[model samples]
Every structure is written in C-alpha cells, then in structure tokens.
Target: MTHSTDSNQTLFERAKALIPGGVNSPVRAFRAVGGTPRFIQRAQGAYMWDANGRRYIDYIGSWGPMILGHGHPAVLEAVQKAALEGFSFGAPTEREVELAEEIIRHVPSMEMIRLVSSGTEAGMSAIRLARGATGRAKIIKFNGCYHGHADSLLVKAGSGLATFGHATSAGVPPEVVQHTLVLEYNDVAQLEEAFALHGKDVACVIMEPIAGNMNFVRAGVPFMRRARELCTQHGALLVIDEVMTGFRVALGGAQSLYAQQIPGFRPDLTVLGKVIGGGMPLAAFGGPRAIMEQLAPLGPVYQAGTLSGNPVATACGLATLREIARPGFYEALAARTRALTDGLTGAAQAAGVDFCADSEGGMFGFFLLPRLPQNYPEVLTTDGARFNRLFHGLLDGGVYIAPALYEAGFVSAAHSAQDVADTVALAREVFGKL
Candidate 1:
C-alpha cells in the first residue's frame, strides 16, 4: 500500500531486465510519447491507481473494454460466481450459448459466432473463414485499419496500385503478404481500382467502420457503400473489423450506424472484441450459418484454440453485454463523450491551439490539427511534439488518456459529468500553455 513517488519508475527498471522493453504491449512502453509508463496497481469505476498510488481519471478504459467502467457490481458478481463454478472447461457450457445468443440478438449481421481469446485471433479466424468459404486467395485491406497482427494482415501499402502490400513487420515475409492488397482509406477511386484489378481472386475486404487506430477517421459513407457493392459484385466477403467499436460504440457496433446511413447494409463477416469481453480476454467472429459451419468437423478450414471459450471470460463478457444493453446506456455515454470532445475543441479555440475532435457512442478521438483528419496521411500531420506536451500535462494533472497520439480515447458510463468537466478544465489550462 505504501510506496515511494518513484515506484513506477523502479518497477519499469526491474521489468526491463526481464521483459522486452519492460512492456507486454508496445504502446504501453510509451515509446512514441517518450515517458515511463504508469504501472497500474488497481482500477475502479472511471479511475485507476498507479504503483505510486496516484489516482487518475481513466479515459482509456482498458483500451475500450470497460464500457460500464472497471469493476461494476453486476459484472463482478457474474465473474465471481462463474469463477467459483469453474474456470476453463475445455468444452461447451450453457453460459457460452447464452452469450452467443445475446450477441447475435443485437448484431443481426452475425447469425452465428465462434468465440476466441483476443481481437487478433478473431480477425485471423475471420479472414481464414472468408478465404475458405469463397475459395479465393487474395484479400484487401485499407491503410491504418488494424485487423490484428496476423501475418497476412501485417502489411503496408505498396507504392502503386498494381503491386500488393509489402510486409510491415520483420518476421512477416514478402510472400506472406503477396495476396494482401492495401489501399488508402476513404479513397473510393483507389478501392474501385483494386477491385477492378483483383475482384475475381479476392476472398474478402476487411476494414474498421471507424479506423480507431488512425485516431478515429471514419470510413466515408460513399466509401463504405462502394465496398459493400464491390464485395457483393466480386463474390468477396465484406468483413467489418469492429473489435474496438463493437458494443463500445453501440449495441450493434459501428456497423449499425453505417447500416442506418446505407439502408439494409451488413457485412458478410464481423470481427468483435474489446467491450464484448468486459475487460477479459474474449473475442469472436461470425457470419451466416453456412459460412460459420464451414469450420472444424463441418468444413475444411481448420482453426482451434484450447482457451477458445474460457468460462470466466465468457461470464465477464455476458455480464458486460447485459449491462450495456440497458435502455439509454449508449445515449448517456455518447453525451459524455461529446462533452469531453466539445470542451476540448472550445478550449483549443480559445487558446488559439489548432485542435479538432470527433466521437461516437463511448469512443472518441482528438487531434492537434485545425481540422479533423480523414486518412492516415492526414493523421500523421498532427503535431507530435505538441501532443506529447498535452499528454504529459493531462497525466500530471491526474487525467489519463492513450499514451499515443494515433490511438482513440474512450468515455464510459461510469464517467460522471464532473469527470468530463474536470478533464476539460485541465485540458483548457494545457491548451493555453501550448
């Protein structure tokens, strides 16, 4: 309970000796921001305490999983009861079926689902299913839209449209990504060109409804509509990567929002994670029954995980889903998120600091640019030095957001009006200095 002010630094130093870069996750190292990552000891609704016992208003929300915020009473009870009953069964349970039913009920696009342990696993499995069902070898992705670290997906855009993407990661070789084509996000012309070139051989086109990793640039409505049309025309599956937006953005995820804009729109395969697991390690991908049945004993595409449906993770996810399903949950969460962004925008305007922001449901993003960015190249234009100052300023003032500029921030149901007000007030001060 008692620790020195430098406890976080001390722990980081010790961990560096044992763990690579002293972090299990790359961003957690704060490499982009150039600071020691806070060693979190514990978290409670809308707040987290670090190793030095410093309490900060948590806006990250465990990178968009804690929608109802950390340790809700109902979620805690479900998890505790499930834990008492058992952990992983290495088999099926009633609760797993119940959770699947719940998700399908809300996300109509997913007629069936296969649960996994993380977003990466869900995305990887979805691509495989697409390839298997369609009997196609090529896949298409957009720049800055992260599906996972899957080898084929770990690719960057080539210099020209004709060439496929090159491997972004070291271990991922050229041949691995040869079938992967990466195009500029929200660029309808380029998308059409790609489909025109490789339509017949394309298995699927995967994308985030809102590219959260690129700091929340929306996939333009025209762009999304074209994607759906092209995929259908080409006999390629449309995979919506809603790992960050599922349940966090709305009951049906970001796809629901897009469907409203483009009537009767739906993805062929949907990848879900984050809030679905309620801060636990659980994710899933699903589609029509015929496509889903293509896996395992039913079909040729083989994928398996020992901890696919861990009892505790499903229990936590089910509990979280039930809570967010409540009436007015998202309406209230959206208002809070808007408040945070609006306040930041007003503060930046008053201080003459170039800034803009956008939000959807509980998820939000901001940039130190005069206008909101629409693509990865535009996102790169954000002032990194200024952002680092603002990040540290907020952290010092006991408000924590994502350490990296390119990541989205989250607002939870647990965040009070006062919490948003405090954050805005602190941000105003920081903006003046900037």
Candidate 2:
C-alpha cells in the first residue's frame, strides 16, 4: 500500500512555517522515525482521527494522561462543569485543596504539597527545595531519566566518574552544569562512588523510579535502596521524579511500588505530572512538612506560579483520580496490558524475530532484541531501522503507537480484549514482513 501525503503533508508544511520543527516538542517532529507528523483532529476512547480523517487505535494515550481513555464521560463532565464555573481566577480555589488532599491521601509520602503548571516547574522546584533545605549545591541524576528540560538536569556525564556533567542542549552554559552529576542508570557502584566523593556537597539525588523515557527501564532494587541509604547517610534528599509514573504505575505511583520492594522506602520529595492532570497542564511537587516548609511564604526558598492550582485542571485531575481509584481499576488495566504484551512477544517469537518486551500496569515497551535492556546505552542497541519499518507497518495496519521507539506505549482502561487481540494480530503481520 502506497501511503499518500495529501492533507498531512500540507499541514506539516504550514506548521513548519509557523512553529519551530512544526512541533512544540522535539520528538513530535518525527525526526527519529522519518515521517511527516500526523495532525490529529480529535480523539475519542482509544482512537484518534488525523487531519485526513484516518482513524487509529491510539496507544500513546496523549503521552500518558488519558488513563481512563480519551474523552471519558466523568472527566469531560468535571472539566465542563469547572469551565462553566470559571477558567482561571489567579486566586485560591477550594477544588485545588481538594485535589491536593486526594493526592496526599493516595500517596502517603506527600505530607505537604504545592501545585505547579508543568512537570518542568515541579522538577525544578523540587531541586530548589532540596538545595534550600540542605544548604548544598550539587545534585545527582541518572542517564535516560529525563527530569523535564531544566538546565541543571540537562547535563550528560563526561568520560569518567567524579567528573561534572556537560550540557546536552544548546544555550545552557557549561558553568551551570558543573555541580550537576550524571550517572549511569542501574549502576549501583557508580552511584556509591559519586556519593563517596561528593556526598557532603550533594543537595539531592533525583531519578525516575521507573524510567519511561528510555522505553520503560526500571531502577534495580539494590540501586534504589542504595540511593535511599546513601542520601540518608549524607543528609541529601532522595527526590523521585514520578512525572511519568505518577498515578499510572499504580494508585500511589512508582514510590508506592518501590516501598513494597524495600520496606520504609520513600523519597524525601516527589515530582508528579501526566495522569495527575488528566490531560491538562498541571503538576506538583510534595514531601514531608519539614522539607516542604522551606518554600517561600512559609520559609526562605521562593517559587510561585500564576496558574498554579488551576481549578479546571484540578477538577479534571480529581475526577480522573476518583475513577482510577474505583475497585479493580488497576487490576483490569494490568491484565489487559499483560495480554497485549504477551501476545505481541509470542507472535514475534513465532515469526522467528528477536524481541524482548516488558509491561507493568498499563505501560509497556518492546525491543527488537532477545534480551531486555537495563540502561540507556543497552537500549540504544535496538535496531532502529527495523523499528521504523515495524512502526510504519503498524500505522498501515491501524494501530498507533508513539512515533519514536525510545518512548513507552500506554494502554487505558478503555482498551478491551478485542483491542489487545487486534493489536497483537497486527503485530504478527508486521513482524512477518520484517
């Protein structure tokens, strides 16, 4: 089948003229996949209609916010009701407090919380709070664990351990990242050595408990436990950036999952986004009272947002949370997700393809290799050309996943057994071709 470039091409051309790379985000440009970006018109349930009226079974789930699926009745109703009340007041609202309380009730680690407009703001604020509370300068982060696009967090490590990270993006001065330490994911030895060298100067160690940016790599239990121990021993805070995993991995987020594995394991600060906003631009950072009180109006550190605690966003988030908290919500979602992944892996094996797939709750990823990767460098060894071919093949077959292979795929509660089976059948056909 020859794919036609009609409306989507025209839209991309027009968008490129207006917006940089024809996208607000870099990955949306389809630079890695080499295709014209699809201009989505509308989405309902698990499907999206592109500019040309082409329909697809969306697996991205709006990059992880639409857990209850696109246009869920409850979420829409709450959003519509909130919209009728007002859009933004730039003042306090009762719903914001309610949302905060709901989050705190679910995630016990959050004793005090503050709302923000984006994940970047939440992550940046968490780092600042850590620095202020500890009076330390340096911070540690892991590779492939993206903490938004903050300047300090953008640094990539140099050749050796104990060396400072260099900025990965332009416009970030070298001096800004001098105190930023970037270590390898799942590398407990490196993590220990870094603390040994600069534990006293380190303010916090920020990481994604379950890294979805590098296609759903998880932090090893020992690595996480050691990180928590080292941070505690050094008087540095352990900040878990749950921007992607928050409310998606489980009811209480990745922190809850980690706590089960390592008893009494909770980060000093947690950064949240994605599902928490229910597709709106909302995020938050929270921790214990002692650390949270360092923020201004209560203490010394200063951080504020005009749109912080937005009412409509809060209403949407609250409704989504309530829906997810329903009995058997996660269990059903996980079962369906497992079915999909297992079917896909089995199909690939039957076709004599080298594939490794893993799923947790509603999120999953697969590599065109036999063994699952544990870190960014290992994940980079995936066959990009094969993935691009399979991606386009799946697009031709009516299933939509993230255009980039490095990003994880999501399944919503709306996905049925039929959706999983159909997706697996499509994958079988695609793998056969490969």
Candidate 3:
C-alpha cells in the first residue's frame, strides 16, 4: 500500500489560508511533530482514511469518545432515529432524562446532574457550583490534570497547553486564576500544605483521578487518600474530573477504580465527557442533591447552554453506554489494551530502546523512557525528538496515534486481536529502525 499524503497536503494548504493554524483544535495542527496534518475524510471501526485515501489504524479514537469505534451500528442507529424525531427542542426531552438516569445509576457520587455541550462547560459549571455551594472563592487544581479550557483550569494546565508550553493562555486575565491554586499531580505534602494555609477559604479540590493529559499518570494511592481527607477536613468538596476517563475507563469511571483501592471512596462532585457523548458534543457534571441543587431554579449559581442535552447526542451516548455495560465488555477491552502495551514493551526491550507503557481499560499511553513519569515535570523528561521519529514511522506504517506525545491514546471495542497484532508489528519495525 502507498503511504501518500498528497490530497491531505493540498487540503491543509487550503485550510491554513482560512482557519487559524489550519485546525479547529491546537494539537490537530500537527505543529509539535512538524508535518502535514492528515485531513481525515472518514473513520470506521479501528481505521481512519485520510484525504489521500490512505488508511491507518486509528488509536486516537476521536480523542477518546469513539470507544465503540467510529460508527458502531447501535450508536449510529440511535443517532439516526433521534435525528428524524427532531434535532433540538430548546426545551426538555425525555431522552435527556433517561441519559441522566443512566449516568446516576452507574456513578454513586452523583444524585443530580446537568448535561452540557462540551467538557469545558461541564468543568466550568462544576467549579461555579462548588464555589456557590461552599460559599468560598478559592479552588485547588493539579498542574497536569486538564479539566478544560476554562480560565481557572488553563492555569499551568496540561495536554494541549503543555504541548504548547504556555504557563497560561494570554487571553485569560491574571485575576481570573488568582484564586486557583495549581499544585503538583501526586504531591500529598503540597496538598496538605495548601489546605492548611487556606482551608477555610478553599471551595473545592479538583483533579483527574488518573491524569490522562500527561499521558496516563495515576494519582498515587497515598496522594488520592490524602486529597480526599484534606478536602473533608477543610470543609471543601473533592471534585474528580473524569471528562477523559468517565465511561471510557469503566462503566463507573476512574472514581470506581479508585473505590476498589480505597474503601467507601467517592468524590463530592464528578465531571464527565468523551464516551458519554459517544463522539457527539455532550458532557455533564453532577453531585449530591444538596450541592447540585445550588445550580439554577433551586439556587443562585446560574449555568445554561442553548444546546444542552442535545437529543441526538444523548441518543448516541445512551446507546454507547448500554453496549459497554454488557457483561465482559470492559474485561475484553482491558485485555486488548494490555496486549498492545505488553507487545510494544517487549519489542522495545528486544531492540534495546528505553521505553515504558501503561494502560487502564481502553485508554493507554507510552513514553520513550525506562519508566513511566508520575507528573507533568517528570513526563517532560521523555525524549521528544525520538518520540517524533517513532510517531512518524508508525504513521508511515499506516498506524495513527496522537500527534503529540503528551496526549493519551485510546483503543476501541472495535479493535480485533488482528488489529493489535498489526499495530505491534508496525511498532517493532519502528523500534528496529531506532
């Protein structure tokens, strides 16, 4: 098969003249890796076809929402059927209520929830709800765990912000993030210190239970325990941001995974997206009734979206969730992800390359280092130049991973054993060259 990107190059050239950086999202520009960003024409199962009609095994999975893969029959059918019913009511819909019920049934922490159009909206609203409920101003967030592009969240944020190396975006004013204290991802000591200093003033402590933006770093068990205790002791809420991990990690989200490790563990609030939207523009944040009722009609913390809980999006999300909830679905997905990491690790070891990989459920990431990094600063130690080479070599071999090393990759239920084998074979070829 030819690895031609002719049509992709031409489309990108045209896009650059119109769109900023020739992409709607920053990482999609391929600026970090210094290449022509492939203009994806379509995607199905575990494969994507670029504008040049070249096919590549897709690992990005639309950045994580395509856990059932591009166009799963169930999700597509639901979406199509809902579209025919009507697009948007600008009023309440029963399907939205059903989606909420589905989410509440799985996540124990949330007694009430409000659906929004994007992860950023969900995160931003959750912060507002936290501040409003607690009647406090300050909020603590971990450095590498990106909640979204919200002003408070962008402070020392990870993912696209880290890839660009911006301490904070220029457009956001200094006063906006002043109350936002940015701490290290797994530093329990710093967590303790922050609460000790401003315990009374802090409204909440928000973090990704498993930081995906920094390439799959698990918040240390000790650190997680300390965070939960500190938040409770300080009279502050613990908000777990699972926008990337939610249903993708498991039916119950990363919080459930943590619950298994620590007894009776759950966050005061939760933010969700990605898989819940099933590739559509939908996301949500929820918590117990007392805190959640603080938003809208019941209380003063106001948040609203014109297209919140969109009919078609909810249908897609609901279908995807139901399918994944089937017995053995997560077990199979986990095994497939583990197989990919194990294969790559063995190949890298055989080729004498310093490499380490980690996975949980369908999400995974790798670094060209002897071991996985625990935080943003440590994650930075990965050899960027070498990662670029491996990325390009994989791309040439018809396998597509994220353009930047900081981003996490996803494996879909649609990925067969043969697909894993093909990905591993491609990686071995790249490792041999390295």
Candidate that scores best on TM-score: 3
- How high is the lDDT of residue 168 in model 1? 70
* TM match of model 3 to true structure: 0.98
Looking at model 2, residue 233 earns an lDDT score of 99
Q: Candidate 2: deviation at residue 287, Å?
A: 0.3
Task: Report, for all candidates in order, the number of backbone clashes.
Answer: 0, 0, 0
Relative to the true structure, candidate 1 reaches a TM of: 0.97
lDDT of each: 0.90, 0.88, 0.92
Taking all chains together, each candidate's TM-score versus the true structure is: 0.97, 0.96, 0.98
What is candidate 1's lDDT per residue for 1-434, written digit by digit as tens? 67646999999999999999898876576776778999999999999999999999999999999999999999999999999999888988998899999999999988889999999999999999999999999999988778888899877521111011232767877899999999889999998999889999999999999988877899999999999999999999999999999998889999999999999999999999999899999999998998999999788999899998799999999999999999998999999999999999999899999999999999999989988888878887788889999999999999998887878899999999999999999999998998
Better of 2 and 3 by lDDT: 3
Evaluation by TM-score, superior candidate among 1 and 2: 1
Best candidate according to lDDT: 3
Can you rank all candidates by TM-score, best first? Answer: 3, 1, 2
Runs in model 2 lying further than 4 Å from the true structure? 1-5, 157-167
Kindly list the per-residue Cα lDDT of model 3 for residues 1-53, writing each as its tens digit.
46544888898899999999999999786888888999998999999998878
Off by over 4 Å in 1: 157-167
How many backbone collisions does model 1 have?
0
